[model samples]
Target: MESLSCSLFSYPVSKCSSFTRLSRGIVFASRSDSKKHHHKKPHLPKNLRHRRRTELPPDFHPVLHPVPCEGPPSESDSAALPRDYDENDVNDSYDGNVVWESDEIEAISSLFQGRVPQKPGKSSRERPLPLPLPHKIRPLGFPTPKNIIRTHLACSARQPISNQIYKNPAFLISLARDIRSLPPEDNVSKVLDQWSRFLRKGSLSLTVRELGHMGLPDRALHVFCWIQNEPHLFPDDRVLASTVEVLARAHELKMPFDLDKFISLASRSVYEAMVKGFIKGGNLKLAWRLLSAATEGKRMLDPSVYAKLILEIGKNPDKRTLVLPLLEELAKRDDLKLTQQDCTAIMKVCTKLGKFDILEALYNWFKKSGSVPSVVMYTTLIQSRYLENKYRDAMAVVWEMESSNCLLDLPAYRVLIKLFVALNDVSRTGRYFSKLKESGFTPTYDIYRDVIGIYMASGRLAKCKEIRREAEMAGYKVG
Candidate 1:
């Protein structure tokens, strides 16, 4: 191994191996000898030998170590340093104070202590530092400030019920009529979208009401069902009431299967609407069941609801079992006071049923309550008495209405015409027809047909023919 080591380099003492061959026969020392030689200063290259320094320049300062001293370095530090201080050993001993050139130290001191040169402004009397170029000034492409504020104000204004377009009952009625007038083939969604553009806000309840008035309760119920999925537009009581009335009226007028799907899917509000509508449509049995369900659920049962149910069920002798229970339930609640509308609904229902006794009882109740009867209530009462063959009482009610100077409506005039016709009093029927004309109300086809029938019954063939000719001229289809 000793001979092998000597022969590895081109030492003159040993040249036994070709591996030690070099240009100019230069020798490479072994690692141990090279490290021992480094204890003295390293030999400079031939080119740098002339500029070599015996010591560091006075201006070249040593690195000021941020590492703490365990104890002051001994004066014999150079004697203690290893013959070859490995780069790794130096770094480990002094926490890596790697480089400290004069330029680096100057650059670092300039970074923290130097005031950054400012650009010349129009006028600068020690102006403050520019605020960081304000985050690169990007555009978001939003509306202008004025337009934004106007839009916000408009939205805030529409939040109230009074100003909202959908809350305008008259507007809703007009929209409904317009929709009803459209060709059935017209796309309803397109029509609604067009109207929505003009309206500030749309309400589900008003839509239901319009649909109901247009006799499109099926569509209204469809809207009602759809709004369930819309988290924002939940239906309240008034919307439910309109939907119920529409459904009931539709049920009465349409085929049995028309609303069966919606009926099966009816929620609480819809169930209540069904109950009220059924009562209005004279479906006593179903109405009673719905009312019972509503009562059991402790849902909102107003006096008007009870009155309608009572009026309908009380008329049907077989359904009499249901009437008493509802009345008793109503009596249990003190919060409900009968409104004029409730009284009118009851009177109207009783008139249809020809239940004069109940009508008379309702009349007595109204009297005792000191509530003035409306024109509709008095008209209904007269019609009920006339239907029950109590001519004197009916006429007395009419005389009272005249004495009170009540505004007799179209319904009252129609009833009077019919009553006179049924009694075969031709002159009186004609007089009531004259009164209807004087009331500025247009006569319906049914009234024309009744008038012709009365004339024919009284043996006025010539007059009937003349009236029929006039009716035909006036676009009335004479049967």
Candidate 2:
């Protein structure tokens, strides 16, 4: 053992192959030489001999010490070692029963099972923990008092009610009605003040009517002239009638106004309205004078104005000669087209005067001019026939109206019933009354009065009383 230790220092085995070094550990040079040197152990190298002896146990053998080697392993040392036999070669030769030593396995198990703490190795890396799974998020709630999410909207209503005060025509009419209800006074300062502030297009007609009713013709004329100044305002017939009546009265007052003064001051509508108004007030001479002046001024007279004046002049029995000249002048005009209303008015005048030839001539002219007479015109013709006691002729005209698809209204039916009742034909009257009802005309107090009078005249007092009660039930005064 001593010589073996000394030989380890003498020759290093660093260059030796792994198999050669392992073979040298398992084999010896000779069994006899080993026995001869059994009592002589070789000395360790100086550095190895100086290693701390206290690190080893007392039972540890020096022969088991580790010695360092350098350079190549010696060939002679390797040759002296025993031959190595492979354990795998023995299994190829025979099948044998193998046994493990239980005591040796228990020793290794006991070494691991011991509770002694081991010293840490040079590596300091620790095992990483598994990443945590993602957490779930909750949804948002609806806006409410508890949620406190909504805000209040700002207000948009700031304009005053007075800004829209006169927007309603009823309010203006009521105001005029109230003013007219007051006592008659020449001082119209209050009306003027109200007019300046709240007057609109609708209020103009009401103001003129109220002023005319109050006998303040000058103030009414002032209001009518004010309408001429306002471009947006066109005075309607009600306003025109009132203004013209005031002008007719003003014309008779001997005011210092000439023809040119009047013409320059008033519009064509004013002059036309004045002519009609004068005729209405039983002053045909003044109406004729105005019409002649309007004609001489080269101003085109409205067809309605011409027809109306002619009809009114024809109403006067002494002035029947004047109507033909007016009709001749109307026929000569090429630019002025006759309206249905104008033709109907002319027909009515002719019917009133019993001029059937002229009436037929007017009707033919209107038809040729492409102006279809309305239901009112046909009813007028029927009434004219009835007035002459020509009942069959009137009925024939009604049939003509029906063939022409002209639907007679409630007034026309009333006229027919009246005509039949005049002829003492109760059955025909009843048939017309039923037709009136089927046409959805609810009988008013005036209609019921006519019906009651007819029944009483026919000696049907019970039917008259029944109609009176029905009229009373339908919210009409029986008396």
Report the lDDT tens digits of candidate 2 across residue range 366-454. 77877667998888788888888888888887778878988779879877876776777777777778778888998766667777777
Task: Give the range of the ten consecutive residues with the poorest summed lDDT in model 1.
Answer: 1-10
lDDT string for model 1 (328-415, tens) is 6855775647988887876776566555676687688777888888888887887887778887777788778789888878888887
lDDT of each: 0.62, 0.62
Best by TM-score: 2
Task: Tell me the spans in candidate 2 whose CA falls farther than 4 Å from its real position.
Answer: 1-168, 181-186, 194-205, 214-244, 249-257, 264-266, 335-342, 365-372, 382-396, 404-479
Cα-based RMSD of the predictions, in order? 28.7, 29.0
Cα error of candidate 2 at position 297, Å: 3.4
Report the backbone clash tally of model 2: 3
Pairs of residues clashing in candidate 2:
2-41, 2-42, 12-70
How much does candidate 2 score in TM-score? 0.44
